[model samples]
Target: MTPPPPSTGQPGPATRRTVLRALAALPASALALGAAPGLLTTATAAAPARGYATRYTVVPFLDSSDAGVSVYQSDDATDFRLIKAAAYTPPANRVRDASVLKHTDGRYYLTYTTHTWQDTSTTIGFARSTDLVNWTFLYDYTVPIMNLSRAWAPEWFVDGDGSVNVLVSCSTTADEWTFTPYRLKAADSALTSWSAPVALSGIGANHIDTFVVRAGSTYHAFTKNETTKYIEYATAAALTGPYTFRGTGDWAGWGGTREGPALVQLDNGAWRIFFDGYGDGSYYYSDSYDTFATWSAPAKLPAVSGTVRHFTVLKETVTGGPTLPTGVTRSFRSANYTTRYWQEQSALVNLPVVGSASTTAEKQAATFTIVAGLADSGGCSFRNAAGNYLRHYDFRARFDAHDGTSTFAADATFVLRAGASSGSVRLESYNYPGRYLRHYDYQLRVDAADGTDLFRQDSSFAAVTAWA
Candidate 1:
């Protein structure tokens, strides 16, 4: 069946009796996890310990050919690998826009839209799974509204007080469609009982695929502006109410065609928004340090194996802190001047230089690593690739081979300061409070903060390994 367009919206009218019969007729063996490993089996692969917050995003998607729900899992958010193909087989011939929510009790509830554009009586389907691989289909339900032709992209957000909020895109008209977001609240896991659907105001008409995420004290709602066909966002202090529209932009990579936006926060404190390129069968993402005020350019993610549409991401809580980069040597690339590297040359009388390197091997000579203490601690020394330590002579920074003397320890220590650029860090002299390691006319030196954009960018350096 074709996908329903904005105009001529329709709803599926599969009865509760039919749904109950289908569930009862299904064999127990079909739902049981037998000798073979289940699709949603717990992952045993050990992830690299980077001391960063680890998150597992479980994506529920539609396998259009099989007319079923499949699942994928991601540790890094950007790279989603298939976990269970066709984890939940729908009773209908087609289903789309799947969202999986992990309940407080650790079970997962998946919701999706059943029937494609061909059916007028579209319904929202439900399934529950203790382990994501195996799903038991619950009864299908429709919004208790007159002439509600379509219900699409149902996503759930559990509030702090334990109430569940499900945001759905729906329309009531026949010839002209005015798709809008509506909220349905449920207090218990059954999900059979829900509050009457209430229209989410502030955002204009023709908006759909509503996904909300809470950061700090504020809640942000990401929705697709169907009239404009671009993903936009709104924010509110409370989950239900007065959300201020925060302008429209194409932060989800490809313009016009991108929709079904989802969000996840990385352990490094960066936020990412994932959007589906529905026409291209790809997913695009953008990064932001600020809370949706600004965003990085959209980049494409690795393609999922099969045809999929409209999914959600969930971050799993990780034990322990982020894996710190200890004893790891990294080359420093200048943020302001991309081609420049941090270098030390004897020809300039041991002064550190920030200049272009001619070859790949020469760039290695400019690399340095933290020694003695944690990289973030001010007690760390910068040891270059040549096995020489960076130290200061009379407050002037220079690289010198260790002479097995205590003086080397005192002069070499520096503190890492957060840089103006994202993912960049600045080195501040341990002895000087306001002074930072900065490039002065391509020469590396310790200087006081100039408080200029150029100076901040010049002082900032992104640490990278050879293979990163």
Candidate 2:
């Protein structure tokens, strides 16, 4: 839907009806992502451990005079602590709609609109950082369009082939303008060279504040319909796209007001969409289980220390060993032999086998914390409560607390496969992909699958909380 008259600064009733009608006419299957229609609900699941300390860093626009990029970080998305109040100052001294992207090369790039509000300018500010704290302003570019009066809300996405593309809202008219999303490609890692602007299609007319995120194999673009002041989305298979329009959803239940949409995937695998409630001077968010078809009622995030607007959230990876989840320690109980538990014997972590236990002390030996193994390759190593790791020696499962050698790490790592039931997971040794961790006749060994029902049952184990 095209935006309402530009100079009015408000949409009339007819414009609102047009937007509502457009939203209602969207295909139900497209809107629900193939799920049954229902009110927005939140999904509850165990927060997936990052296998390391992962940080969520936010970059928000402060204000006009001091409208520098502000940095805030949180381990969990629920609690944000300010890191740097003014991480970088724009060359124009006025900035809004700040977006940050961490490139594959380990450098960070920040882009924003150099002008605030209706005062149009062709300049879009740019900066880069090796460390998120200190940013060096690389130089701003004026869109090549001759009549370009505004360049606002510049956001960026990195392609699979390592190319960086910047998307920005631009308008040619100074007063009565229709803002549209356009793209620019950076030629190098430093973002010093850029290609000319190319208009994005399939997002409808007069859209702004574009943000794109990948869910599974599809790329979803979320943007504000500047005319209707409602948030809508489209999906594309590739980074540069002939994007297909999805459906529109109201932000925080507010119609014709919410703008500058941003998104973040939480540790619990829930997707959150954040929008600026400019009328209330607060940022509101909604959670979605699927890719953004339906949404939970918009709720305000914990208030930041200062006035913030039009921001971006980025997940930062910290270098270190795996940081095990606080309460993920579990015991593996054999499915075939219900009373038997996997245990590691001796302080050296040798002789790992399934054994019957009658007392609490005996059962404690079976408890283990699954940790990321061997260079944090997403495979896991079980660390017994005795501080020893379950590793394979000579193709036989054993315990080895002191095997700091690469061989031990490689042998110890196992890729976990989800079983048919809840709280059930199967372990496949990294060294032997076709083989699994199974106990044959109560002896722990890594054996090849025989394609028998009994073999599958023997390979599976129920992960239960350790005995009290």
Candidate 3:
């Protein structure tokens, strides 16, 4: 279908048509991953279709200057309704950013961070709301955050260890000065008693929007680089220490700014991040104030699967040759003798000799080799443009999944053929070293979404010796 004009100018809620289109496309085959049995809605045998609204009026709060710690009931862009605003008054330390979460007890926790004056404190605060709107402040930690940039990006995740932690980025200095990344743990949801703000090592010194998510037993923290104009990020295995920096190359320039990354690992082996960039705001849009005047895409919040009737999709592909069976002898992407690594890719590929190839087929096989390394590869993930689904391959990228465990950061990588025949091809780490192959299969899935061209293999083989 001729995709509707890219979402522009419209705000508040998504139009009804948009909603229907997106809803219709939710793949019923997707098996819910990580989430409990009923966390996601199952595709009905047959169901209704609706249009996406033009304006999702569900604004957590009514504010043009960016309200903080809010929730708005919305489906797409057109029809939106805000049920409540932040119970805490917005004084000199106006709102910064927020996240709305639901726990096992049925209590909704609104964990968000505030930007203070003396320093950008990574403060954690919350309120309870039965209906996303109308919040009641249960905790206020905005004050006394002078040590760890005061906690700027305060996102909450239930670690795999079964403990809840507030994943926040820090800027050691004040917001007016400089900043860095840090993590503060909560004994439970009790904001009053925190495990103390601990500085995450490995990150050079300055990073913005520090958030972490859980994947199995490890943790993946997402961060931004203030040192360079181009986008950059870092990853770490644990929550509070030793993060490795992957420079500009991995900075996912997909969106102009590439900062403030929020991630969710959906079922079907997809890891998606909701980030802010140019088109959505003035700071990043090429036409707005301080405009870069380049083809840079704007930094705007991506409309989640819940907000769109339909989503825009951009596809990529790698060919036999740059000119197809002609130009560029850059070696078959999977033809491996040395070692290879990629994040996201398109369609698929034909396996040529890669590792220890003696014959045509041997040298052509795209065998994936995986090693149990630190999950700190600043890799990338593929997107389904239409759905809120993503496939994250980077091990070290910090994720704030609200899931507790030591297994969220980085796992292992599996090497085999292309498609997961019988849909068995998948990777995920949940802690325990017992299931190495399945735990890190996605590690070998390099290159972002490209047109199909890969070998389908079984779990027994890490190095593809044959093709299907």
Q: Across residues 1-468, which tens digit of lDDT does each residue of candidate 1 receive?
A: 111111102323332212223444544322110000000111222222333334565545443442776777644554465788888887665556667778777888887777654355446778889988898888788777678776766777766566777777677645224566777888456777788888776754566666777765676887776545577778877766578887676653347656677776653345666776654556666666555667666666645622455577766655532222548887777777777777667612122333444555455567677565322242456776667777766445687887865445544655554566877776655433235677777777776554456766877777766421
TM-score of 2: 0.59
TM-score of 3: 0.44
Ranking by lDDT: 2, 1, 3
Give lDDT for model 2.
0.62
Question: How many clashes in each structure?
Answer: 16, 3, 144
Tens digit per residue, CA lDDT, model 2, 91-194: 65565667788876788888877765435567888888988899888787887876877776677766555577887766766432456677788887677788
Best by TM-score: 1
RMSD for each of the candidates: 15.5, 15.7, 19.7
- TM-score-best of 2 and 3: 2
For residue 10, model 2's alpha carbon misses the true position, in angstroms, by 25
TM-score of 1: 0.60
The whole-model lDDT of each prediction reads 0.59, 0.62, 0.34
